[model samples]
Target: MSKHSVVIFVSQRNSLRSILAQACLAHLGSGRFLALSCGWPGMLADAIHPAAIGALNSASMPIPNHRPRDWNDLARPSAARAEFVITLDETTSSFQPRWPGQPDSALWAFPDVAAAGDPEKVAHLAIQMLYALRRRLELFVSLPLQGTDRAAIRSDLRDLAHMR
Candidate 1:
């Protein structure tokens, strides 16, 4: 099996969706993939969202102790390398950073759960995003990365991002 690395980015506030995706992918990939997350430059929280932790815990997935990282944090040589870079938000032009390699990239923008409601509602949205992303990550880890099917893989990634 070809092991791949991925970076998940959300334009701002790595505290929520991006961190959730990073933790979920780490478990969902089951060693076939390595994942990390980063956000736009800004004051970062020391802890991730309580609802993010809750969703992962409720699903029995390992809750990662993630500190919100900025774009520069991801550019460090010691940072995990990425073969794929998935943006969890649409404002890529606003904060995209150069990585060591030109990783295949895609945007998977889900509703900003933090912007939409109370803590309870945010937790619900987190689970919803988790369920959707889990399916995609499963498929991603199963793909033949060594083969010349990159176009198909990219297409599949885009299609998966649009799932409800």
Candidate 2:
């Protein structure tokens, strides 16, 4: 049996954070699990987000062909059932996906690093987002199936999203 299949949700696929998480998880996660990113049909067809690509390039984790996530990708016949659904968008606070089984869903919003006017500013934000998502994912993967650890992980993940 597979550990878990997770799908990540975001607003647009033209930016850094979601794409970075998709790229990172795809690289770091190996084939033990599956990771995918989905955004609304609001992404620009510019290959990849430039700053995001640059940041990944700097980290030596380049994903050159990341496009927007479509309904076909989300509701696919060959797609494995997702064990967890995580949303990583600021505008997705009320965003509820229509997953088939309605698996355990959570959100972990981070600032959009790609929108900063200054390159340095954007770079800093991207670094922050990368680390934040990495930490959250670490916490996510370490969550126990049952017991106090599971409760703690659930609470922390909610706090990461709802602690506004």
Candidate 3:
């Protein structure tokens, strides 16, 4: 049987881009990939942004039930070892934590939708981010992971970061 990869999408706050990526991957990757997400310590929110939830709902994606988590929480010895770690914002991309198993990492930078000052603008950005993330994830799930080496997988992921 082929191995199922655990991928963690990380960001500064885990309220927008990372949350969208996690939901998109979980729904799209299904049996092939397990999706998780986290943010920097002390940056977690009580809940994900409402715009994020609305975006997922519009796309018919599954909404995550849990609150935001700190990256340190996932770094624990007992935590599920991630095979892939992707950062979705500049802050998180600059702060590298030693993930368990030294997961193949990539920086898929996306704008912070939660930072939009207007509610309508926030919702619009969230939808845009959702579409962008879904496009990348669609390509991600189609990769020949079972046959590809770690280096190739890492390269492919980084290449996706360049996609709009």
| C-alpha lDDT values of all predictions | 0.74, 0.62, 0.88
lDDT of 2 by residue, 5-92 (tens): 5655454553566787777776666554467766655453345566777778777875736566643467465666665566676675
lDDT of 2 at 87: 68
Off by over 4 Å in 1: none
**Descending-TM-score candidate ranking:** 3, 1, 2
Tens digits of lDDT, candidate 1, 1-164:
13565655554678777877888788877676777787777646677888888888888888766588787877777777677778887765356877766677888886678776688898898888778778777777677676658788778777767766
Candidate 3 runs further than 4 Å off = none
Model 3, residue pairs in steric clash: none
When summed lDDT is taken over every stretch of 10 residues in candidate 3, the lowest stretch is 89-98
Q: After superposition on all CA atoms, how large is the RMSD of candidate 1?
A: 2.2
TM-score of each: 0.87, 0.75, 0.96
Tell me the deviation in Å of residue 132 in model 3. Answer: 0.3
Q: Between candidates 1 and 2, which one is better according to lDDT? A: 1
* Higher-TM-score candidate of 1 and 3: 3
Model 2 TM-score, all chains together:
0.75
lDDT of 3 by residue, 2-114 (tens): 37789999989888888999999999986788899999988777789999999999999989877998999888888889988999987777775788888889988887778
**Predictions ranked by lDDT, top down?**
3, 1, 2
Residue 136 displacement in candidate 1 (angstroms):
2.0
